[model samples]
Target: MSDKRQQLIETALELFYQEGVQSIGINEVLKVSGVAKKTLYHHFTSKEALVLATLETRNQRFSQWLTVQIAPAKNNQELVEHLFQSLKGWFEDRVEVLGEFRGCFFINTAAEFRDSESEISRYCRQHKSDIKQVIRQQMATYADQPDETLLERICLLKEGVITQAYVAQDMSGPEQAIELLKGR
Candidate 1:
């Protein structure tokens, strides 16, 4: 991507994540990104197109971050532990580029979009499925035969952690997730 296009995406992602998609205007994104209105329009046909691109950018970034953060796991137990640890670090703003956690971006987008048929909502669902696939891949490597139920349970725990930490401001959610993992 050109510098202008990349800057617009990054700026829009930050604003859309911090503020709701509907709350942040195109002009605001252009101003924050230091890109001209024509430049943004040239890169993205419409505000919805820009929003989709922003979602795509965030999905790539967040998935990669999660993968890197948990890459050191040596076993199933370690994998589970590292997953929670990553969440804790994210909740505490230890990830420098991510800043403070504002809940899962995909989840936030889903809630904002509401309509299941909407493009944004579809992207949100796809991002979530991709996350579950990542967990399944890791579990498969660590187990002789990974159970789908176990994979779902782990994903549930992760979602719970994100929700509790972001909504209730309960930092212990990751620890609770670890305990849930231990029981499994």
Candidate 2:
């Protein structure tokens, strides 16, 4: 992507995460991003299009970051541990890949777009499914393959972590998730 387009996405993502997508406007994004209206419209066509681009950009950044965080593992178990530890880091707002924690972007965005059939909500669901797929892939290795049920459990725990951490200001979700992993 061109620098202008990337700048717009980044600026929009930050604002959308800090505020709500419904609360932000195209002019605000352009102003914050320092990109002209013509440039933004030329690149995004519409505000919703820009929002989707930000979601995609966030997904790509998160997936790449998660991949790198789990790279030191020697086995699936260690991989899972690293995954939770990564979340721990994220919860503490220590991870640079994601800036300040403002809850799960997907969750926040989906809440803003309440209609599940809406394009934005659909994209959020797809991003979540993609995250679960990543976890499944991470836990699958030549020596041992985790069952689907276990994968689902872990995914649920991961969601729980994100939700509780954001909703209740609880930061123990990662530890709880790690404990769940230990029981398997």
lDDT of 1: 0.86
Candidate 1, which segments miss by more than 4 Å at Cα?
none
| Superposition TM-score, candidate 2 onto the true structure | 0.93
Model 1 error, position 49 (Å): 1.0
Candidate 1 TM-score to native: 0.95
For residue 57, model 2's alpha carbon misses the true position, in angstroms, by 0.2
What tens digits encode model 1's per-residue C-alpha lDDT throughout 1-184?
8999999998999999999898999999988988999999899999989999988988888888888877777677788898999889999999876766899888888898758989989999899898888777777776788777867888888898899999999999888878877846
TM-score of each: 0.95, 0.93
Q: Model 2 segments beyond 4 Å from truth? A: none
Clashing pairs in 2: none
